[model samples]
Target: MAHAYVTFRIRLARHALADFIASFKSSGEIVVLVFGQVLIGLFALIAMPPMAASALPFYQSIPLLLAHGMAMSLPLFLLRRRVLPRDVVLAMHPLPIPPRIALAADALVAGILAGPLALAYIVSAAIWMSQGPEWLQADRALPATVFSFLVTCGCSSAILHLRARGPRPGPRLRRLTTLALGEPWRGPRIAYLWHRLFWLPFWRGDNVIGHQQSALLLGAIASAVAWTMAPAGIMGGVLDLTASASLILLADRGDKAVREQLGVLRPIMAAWPLQRRALEMCARAFSLAPVALLLALLFGAGLWQHTAGHVYLTLAMLAPVLLVAIPRFNPRARVGLVVASIVILTAVGSEIWN
Candidate 1:
């Protein structure tokens, strides 16, 4: 029976792989991935000198490289569906394969897709390192390269898992939003508060605003472990911790926003009921109102800071929220207006900031 099951799983995996490939055949996602690899390769070739100069102590540089690698991989993982929903779309079709097998196949395909880019990055890093000062050449580029790959894999895995397991916004947002707006503010205050507080860790965890609470705590613990072996700068440790925390917080916020937006459109969701939709609407409203208030506060804070960088970042972040709010003013003009605003704002912001 065990042997039979093993054979069955193999067949299922093969079947899943076939489906996965077929799904991507016409998607043009692979073309985009190839183009991106080429662009990165070109950029690396041009920027080799600066990149080499940026290298630090092996210990310090390793984490920095890993962090950068993870950051680079993150957006691709996060926006994978925008290219092709190959995994979800393929999984939806009726097949003898189990969901787990299908998921594994999807992962395998994604790994294959990422392999070229990973190779290019490694080559680029090696070339860059070779151009650095002779003393720095002693730094083990192989270990750093391996670390970067590991970071990319870890981040990609985490993002995929989160995407698979995170709360489905369509149902949750529709239900929550409907409840908040349909009923008076007094109704279910405790429930509403609980929901609000649930995402607070994610908000407070944001790195941009400098609240790296979780990352700092983890890094401090790691630093204490490292200190047992050698001395580490307290300031450097704090900054690393903060950066890690901010990265996590920012990722969480981005995912939460996407989920909430999905909820707003839940009314059009074929599988959900009116009651669920109503509740989701309530949740969406509740989530969005505070976000707007937060943006206003951020705008004020940015003005107070009087730094062009902060002002530009604040504006970049708030542009989306403002675009989201446009529907309220004129529901019919929402989509076009939002798209236009985003284009104009992004173009202007990039020109000014860059």
Candidate 2:
């Protein structure tokens, strides 16, 4: 039984490996993952100097390391279906292999893929800490680093599991309700007034405000309030709130349009591929708006603060967006044209404007 179990596990591992490789069949997928990796590497490099200057004790670097590690993990988490071996696990479910063994194999495969990125984070943290003031307790840094890494791994796995379930309407509806409750008063008159006065402009022509937009707005306001009340880290807090709010607003508008088109007219267009194409177009447009706004906001902040690094950071952040946008080109020749345009714009803006 033990030998048979081992063999089954080996097969499962191979299946998982194959699924991971299949994800990169398209040039676009390869570009997106590679770009994401490069962005993570750049962020670590850029953040190192400032972190070093803070002169935080080695032990203190732990929280910062954890924060950065989690941040780096989030993009991958959001794109887990593209990066993970989901198909393999699902395929092997009816097999003779035990569930635990199959799960262990999946974890091992995921860890292997995520290992190098995780190591890059650790190395960045170590290098940044080495340049800082001497710590009274250097030994504690190692333990803290390990703990942070574990926390990140755990969180990453949980995110993958949740994402595998795919998008559902229940959570969306619940979030919308929560956002509606965020208005000044819970009374029916107040709620109606709030909807007609404040939310009407934000609502789509269909007479309904999107749940995602409302939730995002609520989150942004909450973040801004928290940032205002916080003693330190106000600048970072404000930037986060502003960026998130902008992204939410853009997403809300984009999603509302797409939903209106798909839900109301989908039955008529059920046989048409154009509906799918339209949705994809709206999605790309929606995704890009937040990024553009983020870059502009970052540039404005950089200009005001005279921080070249922030501007450069913002440019680097666009790599993933560009990668995703590349796949939207129907013709292969258009890819070259789009790529060239992006390069020219990035160079002119980052070098000349900044």
Candidate 3:
């Protein structure tokens, strides 16, 4: 029975991974972005040992080492939700599967998600061994890598288990949102309704406000990191670009979710054209509000290395609007175009404008 359960989970995860990869393959831009990120990460890992050993002092290098390790393990952490889809989680939660078997299944799924990173680490390890640096001894590297893998997989699995069994915060979150939006007493009924509609995506999911909250959190963290590493050096430029890309991705997800919701309400929207227009306006405002605020934080905090950085930031700010405004291309293709454009703009800013 345990064997059957584990097998079922593996099959489900396989299907989910296939679907995820297909989505990635469907867009040339996304494929490029994915490959580009992987290559960049591989390069960083390959440079880690030498960088740690000689570039920075030992105290400074500790953070660098930890950061690189986290970077290597991040794929499994981020894609945990993707590999074990909510449906699969819901299906498996009621089973009588043993704890050890369930854990093993989760570790296997995490391994699958982190496969490319694993390969990258192996290559890095081989290179490090060939050099045999005294500071970053090759012997210690294997144990560190193994520990990172175990911790990452175990944490991801634990999070999955907790989320599956956790209480749904959707209802309470909706009430708070309603209160925040000035629902009954403050705004006009149609305006309130449409604006409320804009926020429906955040609170509708099993993970209450997970999507938008993540974007906000990332923006905050990026700003904080940039501020901490003041003077906007190479790392700052990279963080700025990376943060913008992450925000664009989050905006893409939120925009897709809102559009999906609107699609389901097409009949009602058609019946009330004013409501549709109002919703459109509300969504644009609501979606761009965070972008505006984050940009303000960046500017006020002096996080931009050069004035040209704002140009790329502006393009990122416009991405969500352009993503919805442009209708000729499919969403996936549109995303590719938007991301590619931003990347190019950032490259131009970094290479020429500075």
Best-fitting candidate, measured by TM-score? Answer: 3
Better of 1 and 3 by lDDT: 3
Order of models, best lDDT first: 3, 2, 1
TM-score of each candidate? 0.36, 0.41, 0.69
Candidate 3 local lDDT, 1-354, one digit each (tens): 558766776787788678767655534465366447766665547645433443456576555555555655555545556656666667766878787776777666666666665676677767776776666655445655655555555655665566445335577767876776665557676656654555554555444345545655576557545643544467656655665555555556555555656677777678764756666656645655555666666556553665665565567566666765654467567766666765765564454233
lDDT per residue for candidate 2 within 187-287, as digits (tens), equals: 55533443433344344222333544555545544543443344435454334434333343344344434444445555755675454554555444554
Candidate 3 residues lying further than 4 Å off, grouped into runs, are 23-38, 41-77, 83-94, 98-104, 161-185, 207-213, 220-254, 267-274, 297-321, 331-336, 347-354
Question: Rank by TM-score, descending?
Answer: 3, 2, 1
Error of 1 at 303 (Å): 3.0
* Tens digit of per-residue lDDT, candidate 1, span 188-239: 7544543543343233311121233334334534532332233235544333
The local distance difference test score of each candidate is 0.45, 0.48, 0.59
Candidate 2 local Cα displacement, residue 239, angstroms: 14
